[model samples]
Target: YQNDIGQREAERGHLARELHDNALHQLLMLKRSVEEPTAALEFPAAYELLVADLRQIISDLRPATLNYGLRPALDGLVDALSGRDENGPAISLDVSGAGESYGPEVDLHAYRIVQQACENALEHAHPRILTIRGRLEPDLIELTVEDDGQGFDVDAQLDLAKLVAHKHFGLAGLYERAAIIGAELQIDSAPGRGTGVRLTWHSRDK
Candidate 1:
């Protein structure tokens, strides 16, 4: 358990470094060019390309703030996942309620949960309609990702033997992350039916 936590922390650190060295640095350089307009650079094209790359980097970071506060981050995720043009599956995002901030740990875990849920829907179930919902209540925040895709047996598949053998990928990781945040994760799905995932985080202030 300690090792796993350490590893996760390390990954977060690495991501932070990547953001600082790569994405932030590039943005700064681009900003300089934009400021100095007569620096022999093409007007819109260079600026546009630079901005696009910066956006891509920001998208890659996908900071946890989106998961804990405002709907913009998750909305960005939905838009990106939906791609430049909607391909096969249709994705929707809806967020409601107040409180747009959370502890760093809670935010990070929530962000990861959403990310994992989306990946599972895309790769495993290949759903036709995918929805990501976020609701912030007085004492808790709830996030749900639903997919009208083929479901699986949550219980049977979660057998100790199977889990030990490293079968399911995303759920277990999600469960651990939720546990870290003192949150609850619910997976509702069955064969031939759609999947609904619910994650609830309690407020620290009580």
Candidate 2:
């Protein structure tokens, strides 16, 4: 399953690159080449929207910031979510103790876990404020995604059979990813309290 997910991510990145280098480039050129006033105005406007949409799709498939590092990628994620709408929740990142290098797989899984948590909060919790915090050390890395949103019953939701039956895979996927990376996963939530997904990974576990 891990190999399959990695292969799919690779294919997504490849497709994103192809569309960016070929299709997006051609669209820009075509937009610039339009000379007529009306055609130029309309075409450029439409092309701009298309370009923005394509860029978002590409980013969704594979974040470009991941190439730099996990911190930048998580920063990008927070920025993107914060800018999603004028009324969107306030999102913040507070990370300390950097200069830690985990393998690409670990970094990617960590990002995905946070991403999934944030998405779940937005979709289900209607959070007012979403926070992502990280603590990186030589032997330990701790990451948490928390949201001030309407929480659910953690025990009921964590039933694997029930989750599969309900077609709700977000939480399940987080567990799977944590297990894949040998990380300890924890969820803290209640009926009225907010939800928090915390992941801790030890170097020794790797």
Candidate 3:
């Protein structure tokens, strides 16, 4: 599944680049070369909106920062999701230890897990603070996404039938991603307490 996801992301990236370099560029050129500027003002305005929408789509399909590494990709995720609403949670990321390469596939899966955790928190928990922490060692990589919000029953949510019935795939996806990358995933949450997701991957296991 991870391999399939990676392939899809690659295809999405290619499509995004093509649209940006060819179609979007041509649209821009056409807007600039318009013979009647006043008559085609609406065209320019519409073209700008189109460009912005297309870029956002491209970014959603596959973030470019993932090419650098997991940390930057997570940073981009936090930045994009944070500070959007005044009442939204404050998101922060702290990464320490040796900056080691854990292969692109592993990094991508880890990023997705973190992304899902954050999204779930924001959508359901309504947390005031969301913290993502990463630790990279020579043989082990650990990541934790914690939120100070109204938590849920972890055991009930982890059940497959219950998850499917409720259409809650956030935790399921995190588990799947962690399993795909051979990482140990732990979820801690309670009624009035907060929620925390920790993933630990060992290079030796891989």
| Tens digits of lDDT, candidate 1, 101-140 | 6756676677778878988888889789999887967678
With a 3 Å backbone cut-off (N, CA, C), the pairs that clash in candidate 1 are none
lDDT of 3 by residue, 62-161 (tens): 6778777767787789888985786788899987874445787787788888888898899989999999987877678788999999999987678855
Model 3 accuracy (lDDT, Cα)? 0.78
Candidates in order have lDDT scores of 0.74, 0.80, 0.78
The worst-scoring run of ten residues by lDDT in candidate 2 lies at 2-11
Ranking by lDDT: 2, 3, 1
- Give the winner by lDDT: 1 or 3: 3
lDDT of the structure predicted as candidate 2: 0.80
| Candidate 1 positional error at 84, Å | 5.8
Backbone clashes for every candidate come to 0, 0, 0
**Root-mean-square deviation per candidate:** 5.6, 5.0, 5.4
Best by lDDT: 2
